[model samples]
Target chain A: AQSVTQLDSQVPVFEEAPVELRCNYSSSVSVYLFWYVQYPNQGLQLLLKYLSGSTLVKGINGFEAEFNKSQTSFHLRKPSVHISDTAEYFCAVTPRGTQGGSEKLVFGKGTKLTVNP
Target chain B: NAGVTQTPKFRVLKTGQSMTLLCAQDMNHEYMYWYRQDPGMGLRLIHYSVGEGTTAKGEVPDGYNVSRLKKQNFLLGLESAAPSQTSVYFCASSYTGMGPETQYFGPGTRLLVL
Candidate 1:
């Protein structure tokens, strides 16, 4: 079994300021981590994912995340934020075995990012 | 291309009323999933299907049932609606079983129970 935890519940930042959303996970086996963003009343959009080979992964919208195995963390970061970046972000994880099917994804409670101008 | 589509964008249900939400994907993907999003909480998986005629339970599946009669479609059913079941429902699809699992999501259906 795999579970994810997002440290912050809400973060308010001024536009153009840098932001970091922390995430941690617990799993007995290898795991795959992902970050997703949801706009107001909209479905989720994939922010980034950490599969293998690279600890730092980049995604669309100038967002990036670094996977640290020892720390059990996959934190998302952006050098600068925009007002349009205001939304809810979720971190998810799944184990890496056959029994760990692709059907299941354990998610964090989510962190609401409010970018104010 | 409509990667994924969910029917009934919004609905209001009374207690004990039953309804089914339909999700379809034109991507010919091998994996499909149903999830619910609520305030303060992130999305939780309700059910999923890996292929045609195959279904599996997810993190929160007690109040829901799912069917995958065909590869292109997955249906989520509420046998008896309850206030606790009101949330935004999303459907997603992925292409394969490994590496950088990028699942494309639908627009989502907002359901309110009163």
Candidate 2:
């Protein structure tokens, strides 16, 4: 089994400021990583994913995440944030070959991002 | 087309009550999942189906039952609702294989157990 840990329970930043949400995972074997965003009263939407690619993977809404193999971390970052970026973010992981014939994610406890105006 | 839809956007159930949440996907996806989200807790898998008539337990399966009687629909049922089961439920589906397959989620169903 694989587990994901999000170091931050909440992150608050002023508008136009840069922010980073840290995520770490524990897996005995190779895995896939993903970042998801959930607005108030809405389901989660995929922000980015790390399958097999470059260490730095860009995603929607000007967000990006770097997959660090050695550290077992995939932290999401944004150069600048806006008020609309205030939402709950979750980091998820799945074993390479155990994705229910697809990729099934095991999510973290979530980090609430508050982009203050 | 509707990607994934979960019926009964909100519900209020009492302890020991029974209810079922329906999830339907129009994308012809082969894999479907049920997950619950709570405050400070991200999404936890309740159950999943690889195909019609095949259900598998996920990370958290207690107090829940699932059935995939049709290819496009997956149902999550609570035989005896408990306070612990009050949470937002989400349904997601994805295509099979490694073809950039990412799960598409439903809007969600908010259930409150009193």
RMSD to the hidden true structure, all candidates: 1.4, 1.7
Least accurate 10 contiguous residues by lDDT in model 1 chain A: A96-105
DockQ (CA atoms), all models: 0.60, 0.58
Q: Model 1's CAPRI class?
A: medium
User: Which 10 residues in a row give candidate 2 chain B its minimum summed lDDT?
Assistant: B94-103
Q: Write the per-residue lDDT of candidate 1 for residues A7-92, one digit (tens) a residue.
A: 99999999999999999999998888999998987778889888888899999899999999999999999999999999999998
Give every collision pair in model 2.
Answer: none
Per-candidate TM vs. native? 0.94, 0.94
Measured with C-alpha atoms, the lDDT of residue A47 in candidate 1 is 91
